[model samples]
Target: MKKLKELFTQVKALNYTDGEDVSDLLWQLICYSPKMPVRLQSQQLLDEATSFTLEVDDSHFSHSVLKFNGFIWGNGKRKVLITHGWGSKAADFSDLITALRTIENLQIVAFDAPGNGSSEGELSNLLLFARATEVVIGTYGASDIMIGHSLGVMANIMAISETAIKPSLLINITPMVRLKENFTATMTFAEVPQAAQSKFFESFESLFKVPVSYFKLTDLYTEGAAVKHWLAYDPGDKVAPLEYLQEFLAMHPSVLSKEYAATGHERIIKDAGLINDIVELVKQGNKQGN
Candidate 1:
């Protein structure tokens, strides 16, 4: 709990007016700080995981970069692309990558988004994320499964709409069509002060090293018009409202919707049962030629 509180404190203090400077600070703190227990925990997690090879690809979209880590599981005949959420690195889903490796003929690729992890670029909105995915799919020439978490899920939806790249299955973990609730919950969870919240755009600009106008959340939703087949997993939690999930389902009936009782937004990914269910769904979709 103390460590969680420290993380909350650090999140609350995130300055957005000068994002490049803030990014430098964040890098220094994450890479070298001894006081950050969360960083230590993350490092420990990474150290325990099986290492993969890093590959870099330039994005066709300006101000964007793609950095992916490939983990060849089994025969590597089938490929799966997994994307992480905001403020998360590609290695955050290492557990999932490791577990999926057990299945033969499956290859796993996890990419760090433009603003996060080792990827280069200033902060990017959902459109840029979609474009990055398009570039990855076009470069690889594969249409396997695509799994996304939180904001990454939103980007995936937009990407499918904007690009011809279609995967056999689209799995969204704790996705939200609108981000207002997510922002509210994040602020509450991080205990961000009202004053800080008022300066959110400015702070985000600084934190992401992007222009304030580029942080607009609505643009991402507009670009999400192309998603038809999808799976949405929403736990009864504060991060995303049931109404939001329902709205997404209503718009896309082909979406496989499930609700967990106790699993919150973050834990839903860690749930083995949920993962198995998703894997099964993908297999079913493949069998049905979906």
Candidate 2:
């Protein structure tokens, strides 16, 4: 983390002659993958011998296709797909996966999104993440539940709305409600020039092909989707604001939410009780669906 901070600090100190290039560079830095490796114990659960791949359509770079890497564990009747957040790989859900493995006849799968982990790409966007989730669900063909954290929740919601794979239950942890809000915060923290902020937004929109207005979490949930949602979050999260979740729940009364005191954005998954609760919810939803 210190190294990453230093790298960003150096980049921020650079004197760029071209403002457009600087904006592009900033966007690239945001999109660039900071690959997270799976721990030894977590790697043990993964069936590295058998792997899966998907082709991601990269529209920004001449519509090129990128490869996405993933692994599947267990061969149970019910399927649970785990999606990690920004700059996070599938194996980050090690603790959750360890708990879920005990559930009988439950198949668990996870993947590294394009430009993340071992995936083939240099840059990624929300669309690519959504498409990757969709592809995994489509291929698996029997996803009963989905567990997502932060940006993973955003991708899951987008994939659920856009694709045919609607799971029985969705467990969203520390979900990012608004991309524009996040971007604004990021710019403020990075100390990006006021003149460069607009350029960054414009460049981002052009590169990702999605307007900032369309990036809200509320916009991703479509009515009549046969999915019961559980939202778990901590108000103290530094990256994603808890007020966003509050605002979303206000508008969408059908969703259920739970709050933890100080789980923050990243460590919520580390809670064993929370993982067990998620498993229990999935079981209940599976029974209800059947």
Candidate 3:
């Protein structure tokens, strides 16, 4: 994978037309995929599972349907689906998967969204990820709880809003609030020129079939959700900083927001304490619902 910084250097040196070319290249590069060997921990979880594929609509591309990869663990009535973020595979949730298994009669499912891990395709976006998630939910019949990290949280939100799947419990860890804000921040960080940024938005809106302004974290909650919502973040997180959700959280007083001192973005997902807290919350909610 080419470094975004390196691409930024190249993008910075170009004229408008040339910069547009590089901008397109940079957009493709931003759609990250796994390159390293799957961790033994993640591999172990995969080994104990039955895998399946779901056909998803992809009208934007030539393919009639895309096969989304997913795994099922345990056979309990209680259903939980977990999703990982950009550049990460389902195996990144190995710790949480293992932790959740301890819950009696609990069925857990996790999948590699398109252009990610074992899933098909070379480039993917939020819309694709959400559609893939919607398919998994349909196959699972119903989800009692849904957990997501980083970009996965946004995908989950979009999936829930756009589909019939209404998980009873929603957990978002280090989620991005304003999609456009983050996109612009990323472009700025990459040193993408002003003209290139504008060109990229035009390209993005054309491809995604939704204006960037159409995406807002608040809209997910505003669309009417009776389900329990949990938002967690680490103050020190560099990736999806906690401050991003401040205004959104303020508007939605019902959301349960929690803070951790040193967990950061990546480690928080793998943190034993954090995972335990999440599982405990799920269990507690289960008891309350009963």
| Model 3 lDDT per residue over 1-290, tens place | 45545655765666666624575566754554544458887898899988888877666543557777889899988788888887777788888998888888788999988877887776677777788888887778767788888888888887777676677788888887777777787778767778777877887789777778677777655534537888888878777756767877888889888887798877788888788899899789778862
lDDT of 1 by residue, 1-290 (tens): 35335655676687655432343333322222112123565455455544443433434234334454333334465668777776666566756766676555676666666545655544444544566666666655564788888777877766665665666666778875565455546566665556655466455556556643442233443423423345556557666677667765665565656766677776677777777777676566556655
Q: Candidate 3: worst 10 consecutive residues by lDDT?
A: 28-37
Strongest candidate by lDDT? 2
Candidate 1: C-alpha lDDT: 0.58
Model 3, runs deviating above 4 Å: 1-20, 61-64, 223-226
Backbone clash pairs for candidate 2 read 76-105
Deviation (Å) of 32 in candidate 2: 1.8
Steric clashes per prediction? 3, 1, 0
What global local distance difference test value does model 3 have?
0.77
Please provide TM-scores, in order, for all candidate models, with all chains considered together. 0.64, 0.91, 0.90
RMSD of each: 6.7, 2.2, 2.3
lDDT of 2 at 98: 76
- Order the candidates by TM-score, highest first — what do you get? 2, 3, 1
Model 2 misplacement above 4 A: 1-3, 14-20, 48-50, 61-63
Model 1 reaches what TM-score against the true structure?
A: 0.64
